[model samples]
Target: MVVIAKELLQYEKDYIKYYINFPKIYYKQENDKDYIKNEMIESINELVFEDIMNFMGVVEDSYNISSEEFIHINSITEFQVGYASDNIMSLAIEFSQLAGFYDISYLKGYNYDFKLKKEIILKDLFRESVDYIKILKKYIWVQAKTLLAELQKNEDESLYHIVEDNICLDEENTFYFTSEYLVLPFSSCEIDQEILNLLEFKIPFNKIYHYLSKYAIKNIVKKIVL
Candidate 1:
């Protein structure tokens, strides 16, 4: 089963804004907006939990984990971050390892029923949630960089250069690129397909598909997927 990381969910504009602004909410006691906080929490719950479930159900017949697992992971991640205090990268690495393990295990069809039990233990130990907004921001940047690299390496040979902008292109082309673009520095948001379609470059679908598959397998397997 192909598991789309929570990072991908952040590509959506609303998700990016929420994650980026969440740290500010936590820091400001005077300007605290409970409504916005609650709304952000709700959005996180829906996007991180509900969307994961939907993806798993659609892509794989069965997923080992439950919504509670996500809650537990989030809670534990927050706790670890608080405890570590100064070690944000460590916290991110730990969180990434846990997420990767969960995804890999689910794909391998191992520990199908025990996932929730494990999550329960993690959640129970969590007292204060950590500020993962910064880490998420960094992660988004990384994704954007990776996406840009992929586009550069595998885009049609006829294509000279790729340009990315906030503007949406008309659907007169073969592929309809989603508004979901990654944050910059670590990763770029421009997809090659979008460039090809917009520039009217006639690349074969099979070649594009193969290139994407190879790229995903290489990067995901080597870096994020573990």
Candidate 2:
């Protein structure tokens, strides 16, 4: 269980915005039409995997931290693949099970050691979990960059140049751009606070929160407008 400080969560958001958004903004101003489309597509593709993995990883890490038992590392590896395949429901189930294990383990640990308060252990777990999530996010971003570079090489000339240009933005700017762009839909649905809370170590179940929030909003809007 990792407890992420609110300030650190904000820092992550700021880092992403500064690193990711600057280039897209600059390129949008350049009137590079083909490049813009390709850049957007590439961004969307990268986010499709990154966002899911982040959410799932955070939940699992939180669970592990609270429990103090090394969740078989295989569980994390399985989630990475499950999420990449877009099996979000299945991912949520797996994550929740992991969280349950953490909660139960923490309780047992407290009973075994009368000196440690439950709250203290819980808080420590949360902090460690957040640290783990942050590390995983960085690793996934690196993988996305490599994949994007290879894809750009095979793409049309105009598109390749556009992506290349955007990629040239400093890391902070690029992160900023990508987080803002990809998170828009989630934010518009009014799940921004929920997402922020998950990042802040205030929430225990990110996967459930995210899936339910998004699904509920989509359904409500569909009923109202359609």
Candidate 3:
């Protein structure tokens, strides 16, 4: 087994009352080249810088009109390692922001194949012939309708229709994986916010075992013994 370490780099601007934290990873392997390590670190640095600049632009606009007492901003970044070995790394990074009355969060995941030195996408997990999108969409809509049923049972009738219309699978990129489950995240208002602050639907691997391609099985399921 190879040893890997994750480090958090913190940044704060007291004047704007904002702070940010992001991750940098290090590999403890004799064969690891300096250039590869440098490139990864540089990429992370660039991402962090972009995030900071984007948030600052939003803050600047809000500060122009909002009173100092009413202005408050906070950003929280966190990561979870789903699977890690000598050849593969899968993880998710969650970014949550609270600016005055606005509250938003996002989940981004990366499945990296060390041997190929490339990032994996959703389609890569399934066979080319399989209509993965249609299959995934069916399962997701089932879950959404289940939620709608519960809302109809207890919530007000008028609000139920409004919520139903907004429940949609807008993007296929909002997916990740853990050792046990395939995780999918929903936007804040995409579903009924009254039900959940963050909507993450986790489908167990056993539920979709046969849908996985050979590559996914070898790298993820077999490695995790699931």
Candidate 4:
């Protein structure tokens, strides 16, 4: 049971001035499906507004939560979707924050190694399970130049450094997958792009299918085809 103190949200002298409310973000749920789903909600509830405020030192309140100030929480389920799955292939938790025109993303995940009958702590699944670095290095220059040209055309040359920093792919790079595309999200401010939001690159699965784990390929084909 969640215990709420009488003065939980009261603005007292000793109490925290900045507090974040936990809103229901789960799109679906039920009595039996509250295992992982419940845990995800609990993790988000722990995020404090002061931590973000002190980290970014921007706003004391979340009223101006536009592109300037926002928090995005993302979770990835690698096996059967949601808490319905009896098997836990992998679970990834991601937090993206944008404050005062600066943004950052933090990801933590654990993958169940079916063969080993154990679990592997993965900093990122995309970089570990696939040859993403090789592919990115092969095509980065063209992509970089294309983005540069677009920025120059828009007369936003000041963000060139930020754009350059993101052109590379690594294990620390944040990503999640969909039916057809692998969405790599690089969260940043205007210095990284023109918006204080995530600049996502959606790459087709066919391009990197050969590099995915056999289990992933098998299950994903089923999801996309059937």
- Give the top-scoring candidate (lDDT): 3
| Winning candidate number (TM-score) | 3
Global lDDT of model 4? 0.41
Residues forming the 10-long window of minimal summed lDDT in candidate 1: 82-91
Superior candidate under lDDT, 3 versus 4? 3
For all candidates in order, the CA lDDT equals 0.24, 0.24, 0.64, 0.41
Query: TM-score for each prediction?
Result: 0.20, 0.19, 0.74, 0.46
Pairs in steric clash, model 1: 78-130, 141-186, 141-187, 144-187, 144-188, 145-186, 145-187, 145-188
The TM-score between candidate 2 and the true structure equals 0.19
Off by over 4 Å in 4: 1-130, 137-144, 156-166, 189-197, 221-226
RMSD of each: 21.0, 24.3, 4.1, 9.3
Report lDDT (Cα) of residue 103, candidate 1.
20
Q: Rank the candidates by TM-score, best first.
A: 3, 4, 1, 2
Candidate closer to the true structure by TM-score (higher is better), 1 or 4? 4
Candidate 3 vs. true structure, TM-score: 0.74
* lDDT by residue (tens digit), candidate 2, 126-186: 2322443343244344543564466467657523221222222221211110101111011
